[model samples]
Target: MSASLQKQNIVSNFRQISSNKLILAVSCYLVLILNYPFLAKTFSAIVNSADYNVLFLISVPVLFICVFNIIQSMIAIGGFLKPVLIAMVVISSIIAYATLNYGTVFDFAMVQNVVESDSAEAFSYVNLTAIVFILMFGVVPALFIALAKIKKQSILTACINRSKVIGLCIIIVGLIGFSYFANYASVGRNNRDLVHYITPFKLFDASYKYATRHFFSPPREFLELDSTPFLKSSNGNPRVTVVLLGETARAQNFSLNGYEKDTNRFTKDLEIVSFLNISSCGTATAVSVPCMFSRLSKSEYDKQIANSQQNALDVAHLAGVDVLWIDNNNGSCKGVCNRISHIEISPDSQSKYCDGEYCLDEILLTELDKKLKNITHKDTLIVMHMMGSHGPTYYRRYPTNKRIFEPDCPRSDIQNCTNEELVNSYDNTISYTDFVVSQVISRLLQLDESTGSQSTMLYVSDHGESLGEKGVYLHGLPYAFAPAEQTHVPLLFWQDPENSSFSLDCLQNQAQLIASHDNFFDTLLGVLSVQSKLYQKHNDLIAKCKGDSRIAFKQGYGIQTNEETK
Candidate 1:
C-alpha cells in the first residue's frame, strides 16, 4: 500500500471502537481522569484515615468504576451515546474546575446560583486558566468522542452486549459492596459530604432536581400573609427605614464584629449596632435574599414557597409604607421585590458610580439620597441591595481610593494571587461597603435632622463569602456542610437618636445576641412599626426594645408561633 493510504487506514482503525468498549472506556475516564478531584478527596478521606486498610481503599475506586460503567451502559446506546458523552465530558470539566479550584459542590443551591446569575456575574468566573483547563479536559475529549466511529451491531446484538456489560459491572459492584460494606458505611457515616464531592453524579443529580422543581413542578398558589397591615406609631412621626441589604459581607471580616483588620472603619465610628453572631439563611444570593425577606425561617425556607407568599416588603407596603427596592447587584431582588416598587441600578447608568460592568455600592447611597428628597409617605421602607464583597472579582467591588489594603488581587483569577493579596482585595470591598453604608446612614441622619423623619438604617448581608478557606474561594456550598465564613454574615442596625423611640443601648445590648435571617422578616416590619398577624415579637430582633412591646400583642398583632403562615 502507498504511505498516505496506510496512514489513513491506521487513523481510521484507531478512531473505531465497539459500542460496549466505548461505554466502558468513557465510564473509566469519568471515574478516574475527569473525576481526579473526587478520587483525591476520597483517597484523603479513606486511605489517610486510620480506620481504612489498603484493600478497602483499592475497592473504593473499583466500586466507583463498576457503578459508573453500569450507569454508562444504560445510557450509551444508539445515536444518543456520543452526544450524551460529549455533554457529560464538557459539564464534568466545568464542575471539576469549580470543585478542584474553589472546593465547591454542585448542590441544588449552587445550580440555582448558576441558573440565576447574570452574564456579567457568571463570566466573572471565566479566565484564561479556566478556558485552558476546559479545552484540555472537556473540549478535546468531546471532539474526539464526537468524531469517533462506533462499530455498529444489530439491535438484538447491541442489546445483548449492553446487558452483558451491565451484568458484569453489577456483579463486580455487588462483590465490592458486600466485601467492604462495613468500611463504606463507616466512611459514609463519618464524611456525609463526601457524596456531594463525587463528580458528575452529584452534578447530574442536582441538575435533574433543579430542572424538575423549576420547570416540571406545578405552579404554587400565592398566599398573602397580611391583607391589612397597619403602622403602630402613636406620635405620628414620618418613619423611614433604609434596609441596606448587603451581599457577601462576612462577619469575620468586619472590624465591628472583632476582625483584626479595620474593614468597618467608617461604620465603626458611627452609632451603629453590629450583630456579631448573625447567621445567613443560605450561602447563595438566590436562596438567601428571598428566604430572609419571607416570613419563613431558615429551617423552613423554600424558594418556590417563599416566592409564592407575601414577603416583608409586601407587608410593609400593605401597612401604607412607601417601599422602594434599589438593586445594585446583578442578581435582582430574587423575587423579594416583585410586589413592591423597585429600581435596578443598571451598570449602563450614565453615572460615574457605574463602570459598565458593576456599579460601586455608592450608587445605592446616591439613589437613597434621591429617594430621601422625594419621600411622600409617612412610613417608608427603602431596601438598598448592595454588591458587597462578591467574588472572584472582589477587586472590582471597591474604588481605588477605598483600596485601604495594599497589593490587592485585581484580577478575577484570584487563585494565582497570594493569600494576603486576595484578602486585601476582599477587605477593601468590606471597607468600601462600610463607607457606602456610612454614607447611607449619613444621608438618613441628615433627613432626620432636617425634617424630623424617623429613619433607621439596617445593614445586613444576604450571605457571606469564602476567601480561600480550606481551598474554598467563593460561596454557594451546600448549607449543611458550609463553613462559617459562608454563613456568619454581618448585620448592623443604626437609627437616628433624635427621631428614634427604641433605645440605642438596648439595641446595642441585643447586638451581642446570636441572631440570624430568621429575625430579618419580623425585624424589618418592626423597623417600619407594621402591625399585623404575621408580625411576631420574638422573631423581631428589636421588638423587645420598641415602645409598643409593653402594649397589647407586644405592640404588633401576632403571637410568636412556629406554624406555617399560610
Candidate 2:
C-alpha cells in the first residue's frame, strides 16, 4: 500500500476513537448532571449568586466537562469504560437518593454515620420510593452503559489517543485551578456548601477520610489523668448521682424551656431546674457524648485526644464512686463507660415499651432495682443513655398510646412530611421523653427515701435535631455553621432537698445563665463531691452559683458564653 493509503487509515482510526471517547464523556456528564438533582441545584445557585461572574458561569460547566472527559479517557485506555461507568452511576444514584430524601449534605460526619451505622439504622433509609428512584435513575443508565458496544483499536492508535486525552485533561484542570486562585478569597467564602453538592467525588472523598481516620490510622494510646486527691462530701448521706445522657433532644421543642408545645408536661410540673440556654459540645453523639465528659472544650476537643484520655466516668471510678451506665441507645458509651459497669438493654429484655426496632425511654427504668442492688459502694454514679427523639423515625420512639400530638408525621422519611406534622411527631417523642424522665426522677426519689441516699439527677442532651429547617434535616453539620436547632440542647437538674446543701432558688437563678458542654466536666465533678485538680471551679455551674464566680465563662464553638444571665 502507498504512504497516502496508510495516512488515510490512521486518520480514520483516530476519528473513530475520538468519537467514542466524546460519546463516553458526554454520557457520563449527562447522567451525573441529570440524575443528581442536588448537584444541578447547587450549580444553579452558584451561577445565580452575586459572586458569580460571566467567566465563572462558563468556566464551571467547562471544568466539570473536562473532569468527565478525563474519567472517560482514563477508563477507555484501560478497556474498563463500561464497568467503571456503571459502578459510578450506581454509587452516585444511591448517594443522590440519600441526599434528596434526607436533605443530607454528605459532609465528613454524615459520611461517618454511613460507615458506623448499625443494620437497623441503615435499613431505616430503605423504602419503596427510594428503591424505585435508584432503579430508574441509577440502575437503568448503568444497564445502558453495560450493554453499549465499543470498537477495539490498534496499540499505536490507543497510545496516541491516550496522550491527547491526558494533554486536554491537564489544560482543563489547570484552567480550573487558575480560575479558583484568581478568586480564591471570594470562592472560599461562598463555596462552603458547594463541595457538599458535588456528586460522587465528595461522598468518596469523605468516606476515604473517615475510613483512614477510624481504620487505617494507628491506634492512639490511652492517656490517664494525673493522680489527684478525691474528697467525698462530708455529709453523712451516701451520694447517688444519676446522669441522663440524652440523644438528639433539642431544647427548642421542650416546653420546660418555653417551647410553644407542652412537650415537657411531666417535667415542668416537677421542682427541677431547667437551664434555659445550654449548647452542646458537638452536633453528634460521637462528638458530644465524649466531649461533654472530657476536660476539653468544643474548640479544644479532638476526637482522637478525647478518645485517648480518661473521661469523667473514669475519674469518678478512680475516686471510689460506683459508676454504672445503662444504655437504651444502641451506641456504646464511646469509652466513657469502659471502666464502669455498663448494662445494655437488649431487645430480648421483656418490657412494655420495647419492640424489635426501638425501646421506649421508659424501658430503661425497668428492673433498675436489681441493677442498683449490685453496686456495693457507698457513693454511686449512674449514667442512663436514652434514645430521645432520634429521627427520622420519631414516631417509633414512643408508644402509640402516648401520641398526644395530633396529625403526627408517621413516615420515617421526615423530609417528605409537612413541617407541622414533623413538629407534631417530634413533640410527641419529647412528651414521651418527659414521661420517661419523670419516671426516672420518681424512681430516684423513692430510692433516696428508702435508702436515705443523697440522690441527684442531671439531664443533658448530646445534640439537637434539624427538622426540615432551611432544607437541612437531621444533625451532624459542622459546628461552625450548624444552626441553633442542632446545638442548643436542654440541661435539667434535680437534687434531693433533704440531702443537699445547694439552695434551689440559687440553682433556679443560675438556670437562666448561658452555659455549654464546657461546664459539664467540672459541674459533674462538683456534684459528685469529687475535689480534684481536673475540676475547674469557674467552669462548674453549680460551684459558680455557690459563690465561686471568679472565672469568666469563655465562649467556644457551639455556645456563646459571654452573654449575661437573665
Among these predictions, the greatest lDDT belongs to: 1
| lDDT per residue (tens digit) for residues 1-566 in model 1 | 99999999899878789878877777788888878877887888897666878998888778888898888778866888998888878888988888888888998999998999999998999999899999999999999888778887899998998898889988998898898898888888888888898888897899899999999999999998778888885576687888888899889988887889998888776767888889999999999999998899999988999999899888888888899999999939989888889999899999998888899988887888888899898888888899988899999998888889989998888888999999999999999989988888888888888887777888899888888888887999899989999999988888766545566556777888988999998888887878999989998888778783232221222333223234
- Those runs of model 2 whose alpha carbons end farther than 4 Å from true positions after fitting are 1-52, 71-80, 176-185, 373-375, 546-566
Best by TM-score: 1
Give the alpha carbon lDDT tens digit for every residue of 1-566 in model 2.
Answer: 99999999887766554435644554455445543554466556667667667766556666666776676566644556666677777787887777666656667877765665677777776777888888987888777666555557787887787778778777987977786755535664665766676677677788888888888889888888846647565556677788888889999888888888888888776677899899998888878888899988888987778888888888888888888899888746776787778988765567767777667887777746665665477888888899888887888888888999989988877777888899999999889888888988888788878888778889999999998887778888777788999999999988765455565566778888999999999999888888777888888898855433212211111223334443
Question: lDDT scores for all predictions?
Answer: 0.85, 0.76
Give the root-mean-square deviation of each candidate in angstroms.
6.3, 7.0
Off by over 4 Å in 1: 1-15, 48-50, 548-566
